[model samples]
Structure formats: C-alpha cells, structure tokens
Target: MFRFAVLLLALLFAAPAATQSLQAQYEAFLEGTIWPQAKLAGVSRKTFDGAMGAKRLNTDIPGLVTPGAKEPPRRMRQAEFSAPAKYFNERNIGYITATGRSLARKYASTLASIEKTYGVPARILLAIWGRESGFGRVDIPHDAFQVLGTKAFMSTRPELFRRELINALVIVQLGHASPSAMRSSWAGAMGQPQFLPSSYLQYAVDFDGNGHPDIWNSVPDTLASIAAYLKASGWVPGRDWGFEVTVPASVSCALEGPDRGKRISDWAKLGIRRVSGKPFPEHEARAEGFLLMPAGRHGPAFIATPNFYVIKEYNESDLYALFVGHAGDRIQWGDSRFSAGWDRTDSMLRSDIAKMQRALEGKGYDVGGADGLPGFKTRRSIGDWQEKNGRTPTCWPSNALISAIR
Candidate 1:
C-alpha cells in the first residue's frame, strides 16, 4: 500500500515535469527553426515575436505526431468508406439553400458586382459562402498562431504547417490583420471562405472598399475572396458547373475522369441524356464535358464541365463540388433533389480499400498511391480490371471485388 501511494505521487509529478520539458523544447523550436525561416520570408522579428509569444503546443490537434514517440498505426483501418448520401443531408441542404436565397436578396448589389467583376455567378458564390462557414454564422474559434505553431512544430505534415505559420506571421507584418483579430478553424483555415494563410495572402480581397481584407466579419470580403479564388482556379465565364445525367448502359463507367473529357455534343450522340429531360444547352454543346460518377453506378452521375473541376479546386472531393453545385441550383431555383437516389452498399474499411489499391498497383494499375480513398484513378482502375476479367464494371470497391483483386 505504501509503495503504491509513492508510485502514484511520482507519476503525478513526473507528468507535469515531462510536459514542461516538451513545452521548453517547443519554445526553442520556435526560436531556432521557425524564426530563421520566418525572417527569410520577410516577416519582421517584432511581428513574429508578437504572434508567437505565449503560444503553446496544442497537443489535441488532429493528425499530430509527438516529438519522439512512435506514431501509432493510422486509424484508417477502423474507418468505413461508406456511401456519400449523408454528405447531402436534406435538413442541412434545406437550411443552406433557404439561407443562401435570403442572403442573395440581402446582398443583391454586392453579389451582382462580384459576379460581373469575377465572372462567377452570385448563386455559386453564395453556395460556397454558406458551405464554408454557414454564410459566416459558424464559429471559427481557434487562434491562427497556436494552431499553425503546434502543427508546424510537431504534426505529421510539419513542412506544410511551417510554411503556413510563416505566411501567418507575414499576414500580421503586412498590417493586414492583427494577431488577436486572426481567428481560424482547427486546421488554420482563416475566416468565412476557410482559406489557409497562403490562400489568404494570394486570394483574399478588400471588396467593400474597407482597405483591408477582413474575411471574418465582412460579408463582401468573404464572398469576393471566394470568387477571386475560383476565378484564379480557372472558373469559365458563363459556364454552368455540371448537369446530372443518365449515362446509358453502353457507356462504360471506366470512361469517367477529367482526362477522358468529350465534347458535350459528342456525349449527347453517345446516348447520355439530361436527367431533367432537357437538351444540353446550345452554348454548352461545343464545350468539353467530363464524366463524373461519384458513387460508381450506385448514385447520381454528371456531365461535368471544366467549371466543375474549377469548383473542385476549392475543395478536391467530387461530393463537395456536387453539393455546392446542387445547393446553388436549389438556392436559385427552389428546392429540388437529385434525380437518382444513392443506392445502399456494403460498408468497407479504408484499410481493405488500401489492400485492393495495392493489389491493383501490383497488376500495373496506377491507383494513385494507395491512399485508401477511391479517387478517380482507383475507380477507373477497378472498372478496367473488372472489364479485363470478364465481369461487369461497377467502378467501386466491394467485398467481392477486394477478394477477386487479391
């Protein structure tokens, strides 16, 4: 009993001592490693000190790796890559659409000016705004310095965070925003448009003639910044993002990807029809359109234009782009759901997907690094493999597909 009590006391004291040591190391890293790079990046010492002073390592941030501890195996094995139906929750979509329409009316002139200036539509801007931060209503409560500093000092992707941390200091040095005014998400994405520090420097604009790009409280700045980013990312003028379509059985699902783009007229000739039963727009008929099947044959498909991929530059996920486009349509033209429903599929672990990706890689297929996510490469590879093996191409991973690939 006496030894146990002594051991408990030792552990309690030792934990604080270890934490203090780590904190000291973190401070040293800020001064030694980050300071030199930040200085080289044109950040003033005073600005760096002001921003980083009293900043402590945030151990609770996701994807962080301890200084000297072995990283535990990734928990992706436990995560099931399920159908994307939940991404478009009706309640959430309804709220965003209704609120977006109201904001469209509220900021009518501003939206019009932004659309004219940036060549991006008002509804697209509003939808991106709503999706990013619930039209600037969602709380973004993290300090930019602390989040960036912690990730820079000890996260899995330290180099990325380190660059962002330096850029964050530069943001302060340039008199753009003060340290206290700079609020960010947990991942260090600042303000309503959720841009990282680098993106803020490159894309954020002072649209309300305020002379400062205040994305946090200024709705015009937020909306304009989103448009600027999209425009820079190759948003085509006067082009719609995409249209939901009925891809015929004759059209191979394996033919889905940005690289496999065909003229909209060519796609029309191949028997693809708009789910709305309307003809492809006459202006759009000459433009290139890519096949987009987010859920293989299990859900809605789209004939995505270059503008669709431009939206993907904002957020890489196909589902994210779809949500923004669909929500934008609803915001402009009342509530209407996608024509096709998401078919239920068996849940598969990400690790299992990785295994399938690895197997495909062994068979000379480029599944795009076996990252466990079914990116376009992985999806197309699966369909190609199925076709080669005399089976129907689903273009998605499943339990049977996993076993067969092995």
Candidate 2:
C-alpha cells in the first residue's frame, strides 16, 4: 500500500519532470542546431554568445506545445471573430488620424523627400507609422534575442523562426544595434516599424544618414523604412490605395480579387460608382480595379486598386489594409466614414468557418484553403453556393450558413 502511494505521488509529479526535460532539449537545440545556422550566416561566436548565451525559454509566448505532446485539440474554435465595426471604433480611428496629421506637419520635409524617392505618399507613410507603434510612442519591451530565440526553439514554425533568429544575430553583428538595446514586441517584431528581423534587414533604411537604420528611435528612418517596404512591394506611384464605392448587386461580389480585375471605366460602366458622388479619378479610370467587399453585401464595399493589394502585403488582413488606407485618406482628405454601415453580422469561430470552407471546396467551390478568414474566394464561393440553393446571396459568412453549408 505504501509503494502504491509513492507510485501515485511520482505519477502526479511526472508532468513537471517532462516539462523540465523539454526545456533542456530546447537548450540543446539552441547550442547544436541554432549555433551552426548562425555561424554559417556569419554571426561571430562573440555576438552569438552575447545574444543567445544566457537566454532562457520564454514559456509565456503563445502557441507553444510540449516537445513530445500529442496533437492538441483544436482551440481555434474558441476564438470569436470580431465584427469589422468593432475594429473601426471611432475613438481609435480618431486618435490614429489625429496623430497622423500632427506627424505629417512635423516631418513635412522628410516625408516629401521619402515620397519623392520612394513614390509612396506621406499620408500613407504617416498612417502606417501611426498604426505600427503609435508613431514610436509605444514602448516595445522585450529583448529581441530572447523573444526570437525562444520562438525559434519552440514555436509552431520553428524552421522559419530559426532563419529569423539567425537574421536577428546578423543584425547584431552588423553593429546596427547592441544585443541589450535590441528591444522587440513579444512576437519578436522590432522597433517602431514592428518589422521582424528578416524584414528589417530587407527593408530598413538609413534615411536620417546616421550610419544606421534606426527604426527604434528615428522618425525619418521609421517613416522612410515603411515607404521603402511599400515601394519594394510595388506600390503604384500617385495612385490611390482604393476608393469606397457602392457595389451594385448586378456586379457580383465574386469579382472581388486581384486575379479578377477590370478597368475602373469598365466597372463604372457596370454601375459601380464612388460613394462620394465624385468620378473615379481620370487617371484611375483607365487603370484596373478589383472589387473588395470585405464583409460581402453585409457591410461597406470598395473598388480596390493594385496599390490596395500592396497595402495588404504589409499585413495580409483586408481590414488592416482598409484601416491603413482609410486613415491615410482621413489625414490627406479630412474625416469621412465608410458610406455603407457595417451590419451586425453573426459571430463565428474560425474553425466553424474553416469547416464551411472545406465543405464549399468539396462542392467545387474555392474557399481559399479553409484557413478560416473569408477572403474574396471564400466570400464569392459562399455567394455562389447560396444562389445554387435558391437563397438571396449576401456573399458573406453567417452563423446560420455554418450549419446550412455543412
């Protein structure tokens, strides 16, 4: 009976022992696996040791699992999708636009120079700057090496983070920042621009001519680095991101993607008109535009340009692009809200949406990989499916449709 009690106690404490074993394995991975990659990437032993030697695993980072754990139950279903209306809280948008205007005046010459050099406008840069880190006012408070190394060692995408960790070491070796000074977000996005180290290496620039791309502190470097990223991603010079428009029902929301673009003039002919009652800019009229109904017919719509997609390259979310573009417009053109009101759509779990998407795919409709978020493909597929079932197509996801599609 005493032996049985001891065995029970040992089993009860086995979990902590397993966790300790995993942490040791992660440390070994750093020394053996990460070291070679960093060394091959030209990170010196001194810099590597300085940055990585004392770093402990940050157990607090999201999405971590035990080294030998079973495939975890899907937790994505527990996450509730927020309404787009919630994303555009008036107070938040107001703060971003208000701050953007002030920064625009304060950095007029620098912004003008950046626009001239990169062809990305000052308003766009200001909006991004405001969005990324409150134009550098927000204190990013994690050590880059600690966050990157921990993520690289134990994250869902370890290989990707391993590369990023090596890149971060390269940044340190280049003398751009000391290891101690290399602050980052918990997710390892660094500086005012919130660039991952690889992105920093690719796009960060020495705009202030201070011998370093000081995105951590220099306003010129932060704004210019953002412009450089947009330009590199093929932002169209002098072209607008997109225009808020009243998309006619006759013009199907299925037409909303980079792959399916038509001349703005052609869309105008199709009864798509700008909500402001102004004509599509004469130059833009001849250019291609894609329909962008983020919430399908359930919310505001847009006629997104190639430049609109470029904004998306910064952060892939449609709402993110819309927020940046709209905030920029507010700074440049003054306050104006979306013409159509965002409907109070049904809340859903991303997993349920993924299930709907898979069901749609099985029926020969493309829902863009069952990744949960409704892109143009998913939205159109939903609409097409609704029409097939003899229902009026809203071209958006709904709680009722979750069961209906399945």
Cα deviation in Å at residue 55, candidate 2?
0.5
Best candidate (score: TM-score): 1
What's the C-alpha lDDT at position 394 in model 2? 85
Residue range 1-406, candidate 2, lDDT tens digits? 9999999999989988977887788789989999998999999999999999888888888776565344354545321243878878789889999989988888899999999999999988888888889889999989989888887776777777888899999999999999898899988899999999999999999999999999898999998899999999999997999998997778777777889899999999999999989999999999998889888888899999999899989988888889999999999889888889988888787878888999999899987898788888899898888888998888888889989997
Q: Score candidate 2 by lDDT.
A: 0.87
Q: Pick the candidate with the highest lDDT.
A: 1
Return the number of clashes found in candidate 1.
Answer: 0
Candidate 1 lDDT, 1-406, residue by residue in tens: 9999999999999999999998999999999999999999998888988999889988888887887555555645321257688888899999999999999999999999999999999999999998999999999989999999998888878889999999999999999999998999889999999999999999999999978899999999999999999999999999999999999989999999999999999999999999999999999999999999988888899999999899999998888898999999999999999999988776777878889999999999988888778888899999999999999888988888898898
Whole-model lDDT per candidate? 0.91, 0.87
Least lDDT summed over 10 consecutive residues: which range in candidate 2?
73-82
Clashing pairs in 1: none
